[model samples]
Target: MGPVNKNTFDIGPALHRAILGAGGHDVAISDSMLASNGAASTREAKAFIADARDAGQTPLKASEVEQIHAMPDKAAAKLVALQIDLDPARSEMVAIAQIEGVWCRAMIDNVPLDARLPIYDFKTCENASPEACQKTILNYGYDVQAEHYRQVWQAATGEDRVFRFVFQEKTAPHEVCVIELGAGTLLIAGKKIARAREMWDKCMQANQWPGYPLGVKRVDPANWAIERWPKR
Candidate 1:
């Protein structure tokens, strides 16, 4: 990886560190990065970046720190109930191995200590409510991600493991919700993953990664838009 790029203030990653004990992955936050009410900074920002890089620390703004500390305890409580823990040393386990000659890897956010429990991965999002996250899951193809990760587990253990996501809010209150995809959603996502794998294998065999169609493409309006036109 090249030199780490600075995010504007870098709130999300600092938040992740505080919540998940995911260390050494977040970029360093700078002084000007936190100043001016989260505005972009000048030379001071660059100086802070240099300093943070040398020191290997990303200090969160006091306000940002407050938000992280204020995250509801119920989140941790929920993890405990799920047979997972917030302690990284004890729980942060990663599976990296080959799944039938395909090198696969997955960082388990909170490894289930109990054999009966499902696999859990944590996500920080704008909203942790099921109503909001259901859309997020589908729109972002998280169902496919879950299926893929499950395959990783299967490759390691020779058994199918149920996968789940633990979503926590980034903003105030920092509500948390744990969710598992329904069978139907997983089925559709699994089909998609299988199709993608087949395509990838074919591409590798052909040694030709094709791009867009070799022709001028015409854009068309949606069928609903055509129907909305007044029938004349």
Candidate 2:
């Protein structure tokens, strides 16, 4: 109803476009946004065990919602196999805090076992193998996300917390994997966050919004593309 600040740097969209390229995956922004919204809504619905009840909260079409709800049973079972609880006390909790003069927010997917232990964030993807999920994390700038959440949690509660990702496949025979970021990974992520924050601060101060880098750039063909070329 009121004026919305359109200039805010949302990590999800910013990182997705930056790292994955606007059209790299043949995914348009509108389509990607819709998928993201649906996924978030599904997570919330599953968290509350209200998938059967129509909450009328998601922007996704009714059919889409039903589809996700139906497919999650296998994935849900995988979570149970791991003994991970989704409805932990602080699940789907939102927290906002100021870090280095930037307002940061995080919605924790779940806090299993005890709150003091590691926090878990659920991710539905094409593959749930540790190797595949690790690639997804890097390709999607999830490292930045890990650092951002860690900083926000510490800022809000003065206690450091470990961040973990629970990845599940979106297709049938839904597999799941739990990934814990080690100390070395977090250290690398911290540097990335600092660099991104610096760029954000500069843009905010200068009131200049720039898109992709300027000037002509050389593009290399993918290895598969090169392989497809004539065998000369």
Candidate 3:
């Protein structure tokens, strides 16, 4: 939760910050303050932070280690069902690129073969069905994430790659599904990224950061609300 470091922008959070109309400076300051204050709320969190500071691999908490040891062998089976390759090297690959006058970096969850090929992101959620997962993706800006990663990879290698999400339920009877973005959704994501970048660039150039709009906005009732309580 360090400062936003306006000099370097991470595509994922930058898009979100811009979309929410949050000024980069304020967001950076706020995040840093929060991180500073909340760094040691839990023993596990403190240990992880210490490991990160020491440049060593962070160890899982004792409880987490125990859980992992006790868990059934379901992950491998689920991946096999999803047709995902079991290459350890493919997991947690970092990609870096400079796009739209900003440095961007992404840690791809998995890439089966060549670095320029298709990428897969693993997500554990409540529902793995396409309809439910699509809603979750949009609500969580995963579409923007797909486009951001795609742009970063393309910028680095000059080749576009397919991005897919491998979603599975967090509970028992873990249902799994692989999802790819539709052309329409990708188009919308591209537009969103463009708008976010535009907003960021404008704010950077002006050297002035503004918060939410200055004037009061009108609030209107929705059709459902009107139907439920019609004016007499």
Best by TM-score: 1
Cα lDDT computed for each candidate against the true fold: 0.71, 0.63, 0.63
Order of quality (TM-score): 1, 3, 2
Give lDDT for model 2.
Answer: 0.63
Tell me which residue pairs clash in candidate 1. none
List candidate 2 segments past 4 Å from native. 1-67, 70-72, 220-232
How well does model 3 score by local distance difference test?
0.63
Score residue 40 of candidate 1 by CA lDDT.
38
Lowest lDDT sum, 10 consecutive residues, model 2, at 19-28
Candidate 1 runs further than 4 Å off: 1-6, 22-40, 54-56, 72-74, 77-87, 90-92, 224-232
Error of 1 at 203 (Å): 3.1
Give per-residue lDDT, candidate 3, residue 57. Answer: 30
In order, what is each prediction's RMSD in angstroms?
3.7, 11.2, 10.5
Better of 1 and 3 by lDDT: 1
lDDT tens per residue, model 2, 58-142: 2333443333554446545766787755654555667788878877788766554455787777676788889998899999989
Model 3 stretches astray by more than 4 angstroms: 1-72, 115-117, 228-232
Question: By summed lDDT, which 10 consecutive residues of candidate 1 come out lowest?
Answer: 23-32
